[model samples]
Target: MAQIGIYGLGTMGSALALNMAEHGFDVAVTNRESDWIAPFISEAGDLAARLHPYTTLAEFIAALTPPRVILFMIPSGAPMDAMIDEITPLLAPGDTVIDGGNADFHDTRRRTAQLAERDLHFVGMGVSGGESGARHGPSMMLGGSAHSWQQLKPVLTAIAARYEGAPCVAHLGPDGAGHFVKTVHNGIEYVDMQVIAEIYSLLRNGAALAPTEIGALFADWDRGPLKSYLVEITARLLSYTDPETGHPMVDVIKDAAGQKGTGRWTVIEALRMGQSASMIEAAVGARGWSSEKATRQRAETILGGAVGAFDGTPEVLAEAFLAARILAYAQGFRILASASEEYEWSLDPATIARIWRAGCIIRSALLDDIAAAFDQHLPQGQLILAPQIAQTLARCIPSLRQVVCSAMHGGHPVPALSAGLSWYDSMRLGHGSANIIQAQRDMFGHHGFERLGRSGRHHGPWWD
Candidate 1:
């Protein structure tokens, strides 16, 4: 009998199964289409001996041992729910069902409760790293019952990406925590991508740098603190020239960026939790704003302005780039902290950082520093405000301020970068100007504002 069951055979699912087979674990896979089985088995080649392809769900479930682990890599929402409904009857009392999709946390929480009614364990496991990572080693964030973790740990940890000999898989908490963390991961990813784009825009439009030159800069940065998959890929993207026209491939590609709702969901969750994830929120808004290509084109023609040459240097911009990224992570972790408290999940921010150190799209050397920072400082304080992080930001602030000012002067829309700076400044402010707004509220409406020396709320007269 197979030790584990894979209930989908999509790119990620097949890759996951292949990973398991390569790691010397027994895996049984079934897909919606029966024809896929033979091809998948054939593709396994030498690994086929450890892999089983079942055309039927019954045989697949039967192939697993007692207290079986079945992971679903299907689409989220209604399809995931439908799959659960179809498989619930086949599952034994203690059997586990894992959703390895970009599911809404609310749905995961509901499904966990629903599955518990029948004594079946429901796990919302967040598996990151694209197809290649799935086939090799992916970062896994598991949230569910301890029983489910006990059953699934060996397989998950075996196939998970490792950083300095530590597996990238962890049992985060109960119910929807895994999916929630994944959602925030995507949110941070959105901001990271946006911040990179803003830097590219500043380099290209503001400094009038050639694509190759910009690509070289990114490649050099990749060797430095900005080393990560996204930056590496971006460097490659910039360096590519179309065979037909010899123009940069990125120039030939469509300008619009596509999103899959995880970022938006994160913004919504942050708002509901009363946390300020402004950089992420701005990134989501920027994508929506990017989708209006026609409007942008028309507006550009109608309202044109001559921009002066950028007074900023690449070194200064790089400093600003890193600082913006620091703020982005700060915003993401802050949201996570608030969500953990509100949901009562007891999430370890350090572990989250460590898991993100590899496999995941947002994996970076900064995450290693974040993990260390969390270890040194208590979770009660902001990650950016941690002594070491704060000192670094202090050094970068001058350059970041210059970059933001230059971007504004050059008429470039660096929303994520601007928001990051704003968030940083707002947090550092000893007394903000919002008190005037509070006084305004007390003047018109009865929403009270407390006096500086007093504790209780007091009404104020604006004309006095």
Candidate 2:
């Protein structure tokens, strides 16, 4: 096996290093401190001996073999910049450096251009599956020069989680495209999880199902077409019993949600590009509003009922929720597919389907459907719209659309969910009120608008 250097030992880097070690690669792992090194060595003994600890960036770079391959697994924004800046000066020609962190795709593009001057190859890679997935195998997204990708091929393929018949990692276009895909990958995850949470809450509170009962229901979905990580989480979440009195665990927590950044970025970017990412954006807004309980109190005091009782069993309701959840993801993912086209991202929809099939948080059996959708439309570079998916959407869109509308009527906050649902309607129907969108855009910036109602000119500037 070839030698590889990992420059940071955070959860992701450490797991990658361990995976490499297990596979008999001469993996040199380093952190900024000596203390963190011993524990890793202790836990992974034989693999430990292959580990190389370095207190400084310079030393880590110096230890690499000729035609060096060093992967930086550090924090995203600042740490990535500082490490790359420091090491780029010391690197020789043909030496490749891969940033296996969630750095911004635009940043990757700039960094790639900068590294070219020194003849030091730079690759921006997106690694998902969290820590546990990394240790076993991860879903990796590679973006950079095709030449650099070829050099890292076998090792990357060997390390990534395999699905159906494909590697989780793929050469995703040029420059920042890999990171862009990963960024949107996370955006899709946000929509997926939000829809699952909505379904679980509806089942638990609205349908009044007990915790374990729900678990059994989700377990069934695990064996069906709806099977996936999201469903598995539903099972796990429903399994937890309270520690205080050994009762059901969910009643202990408050109903508040928090987010870091990617969801917000995805929605903003999608809107800026004029793509319909309403479901994903609505999800982001719904989470933001959940933190404001006072608003919920007002809605309860003034407005009407939102989600109501389900007379169905866990099995029946589970299928309904899964079908609804499918519509939500399909809506959000469709926006992503469209945005990729508008921005010239050139994302390989098949690889994305493959990656999501195994290592990522949203891995679902639906990936098979996604794969077929991509294969069917590969020559056209079309968004996901296959016959089976259309049937699934047809089965659930009306219910989801009503669910979103009713929530809004009751003054409940639900941006992504509602938007995602609407996104499906807009794409499938194509008779959406573009006039409303154009009117709003013109109202804000006086941007020249196009009108189908009447050709050549200004359709706005009406007094409210």
Candidate 3:
């Protein structure tokens, strides 16, 4: 019998099955569409020997060894629910079901509890890295019980990407922690991409740099502290010329951006937890604005467009980009910390950093330093407060300020970068301008304000 069963023969599912089979694990595979099973196995070549294809759910369940571990790679909402309902009766008492999709954490939590009533195990696993990563190695965040972890550790570790010889997979916490972290990871990714795009705009429009020049610049940055998967890919993308028109590939592509909702989910959850994710919010907003391409074009025609040039050096732009990137990561970590407290997940920020250090789109050299900072146990779990990060921020903040000012004056939008700077400024201020707003509120709405020396609510003099 196969050791594990993979339900759903989608891109991720097929790749994971092949990955598992190549690692010498016998895998039972099935799909809603029965026709896909034969073609998948046939394409597996020598790996097909270890793969057992089942056309029916009953046969698929029967093919797996008892106390089974079945991973679902389907859509997360009603489809996932339907699959669970169909498989629950077939599963034994100790069987485990893993949801390996970009699921909402709240749904994961609900499913975890629902399955427990039947004495079965449910794991919400966040699988990262794209198709290539899944076929080779991927970073996995598993949220489940100790029992489920024990059952799947060997296979998961075998297929996971390694950083310094350690697998980038972990049993993060119970229920929803894994998916939640992945959501925040995507949120940070949105901001990271946005900031990079803003820098590209500055270079292209303000500095009048060619695509190849910007590509070379990004390639150079990849060898420095800004080195990352996204940067590396972006460098390659910018350098590519379209075969049809012989123009830069990026120049020919439309400006509209598309999203899968994970970034929006992160911002929503952060706000629900009473934490600020302003950079992520800005990134999400920028994407929304980009979608209204016609509206933007009309607005530009009516109000005019950017005419000023950026006079800053590339070194200063790099530093500014680095500063914004750091602040954006700080915001993401703070949200994770807040969610951990609210959900009692006890998530290890160090572990998260370590896992993200490799096999993920956002993987970078900086994560090593972030992991070190968390190892020192940051005060109040604030990543920005860590001495190393704070030192870096100190060096970069001035450059960030210069970039934001120059970009704004040039009539170029740097929403993510500007938001990061604004958040940093707000965070550092010991006193803020909220008192006047509080006085206004008290005068108009009879809302009370607290006096500086007193704990209890006090009326403002504006009421008199």
Candidate 4:
């Protein structure tokens, strides 16, 4: 009998199955439709020997050994719930069902509870690294029953991305923890992409530099402290030439940005939990606004203004970009801290940072530093407040301020950068202007405010 059964032979599922097969694990595979199996087998080549293909779900389930591990790379939300419902009756007490999808954490929690009643183990897993990562290795975040994790650990650890001989997979906490962490991972990715795009805009519009020049500059930055996959790919993207048009491929591509919902979910969760994640929120907004190309084009024709030339060097701008990037991570991890408390996940921020270092889209050299900081220090409520991180910001923030100022005068929109600065300033301010606002609130609606140096609430009589 196969050690694991992988249902749903989509791109992700097939890659995972291939990975396991290549690793000499006997894997059973099935799909919602039968036509995909032949193509999958054809792609598998010699590795197909270890793959047991099944045409039906029942057959697929039966092919696995007792106390089987059945993994689903299906659609999230209602479809995921439906799949679990369908499989519950067929699963034995010790059998485990793992959902390796971009599922909402709440749904994962509910499903974990629902499966527990049937004595079935459910793992809400967050798998990252895209298709190539799945085939080679991917970071896996597993959360649910500890017993289930113990049973599945060997198989998952063997297949997960390794950094310095350690697998990127981690058993986070219970129920929804894995998916919640993944959601934040995606949110940070959104900010990283947007900030990079904003820097590109600054270079293009303000510096009047060509894509090739910008690409070369990005390549240089990748060798420095700002090194990351996003920056690496962006350098490649900027340098890519369209064969047909003999022009830059990035220039020919559509200006409109697209989103996959996880970014929005991160912002939503942050707001509900009363944590500030302005950088991520700004990035999501930038994408939303980018989708309004028609409106922007029309407005551009009607309204135009000259912008001053860029007054900063590529190196200086790189420092500024790094500052904004750190702020974005600050916002993301802070939200996670709040959520961890609210959900009682006992999340290890350092562990989360370590897992993200290898296989996730947001993988960066900076994560190693982040992991070390979290591991060595107590919770300061914000990653930015950590001593070393604070020193880094101190070094970089002046450049960030200059970049934001230059961008404003240079007429390039750097929403994420602006948000990062705003968040930093607000966080550090000893006295904010909210007192007058509170007075106005109390005057109009009798909303009470505590007087300074006292504990009791007081209402204002503004008319008097």
User: Best candidate per TM-score, number?
Assistant: 3
lDDT of 4 by residue, 231-341 (tens): 999999998899999999988999999988999999999999988888999999999999999998888888864667887888789889889888888888888888889
386-417: candidate 1 lDDT, tens digit per residue: 88888889999889999999889878888998
Residue pairs clashing in model 3 are none
Error of 4 at 380 (Å): 2.9
Which residue pairs in candidate 4 have backbone atoms (N, alpha carbon, C) closer than 3 angstroms, thus clashing? Answer: none
Query: Candidate 4: where are CA atoms >4 Å away?
Result: 305-307, 461-464
What local lDDT score does residue 15 receive in model 3, on the 0 to 100 scale?
95
Question: What is the lDDT, from 0 to 100, of the residue 168 in candidate 3?
Answer: 93
- Kindly provide the TM-score of model 3 when superposed on the true structure, using C-alpha atoms: 0.98
Instruction: Give the alpha carbon lDDT tens digit for every residue of 1-464 in model 3.
Output: 99999998899999999999999999999999999999999999999999999999999999998889999999999999999898898888999999999999999999999999999999999999988788899999999999999999999999998999999999999999999999999999999999999999999999999999999999999999999999999899999999999999999999999999999999999999999999999999999999999998999899997569987789999999889988988999999999999999999989999999888888988999999999996876789899999999999999999999998998889999999999999998889999999988888899899899879998876667
Worst lDDT run of 10 residues, candidate 2, spans 377-386
> Which of the two candidates, 2 or 4, achieves a greater lDDT against the reference?
4
lDDT of 2 at 344: 70
Q: Which stretches of candidate 2 lie over 4 Å from their true place?
A: 293-345, 378-384, 398-417, 436-464
- Native-to-model Cα distance after best TM-score fit, residue 437 in candidate 4, in Å: 2.0
Top candidate on lDDT is 3
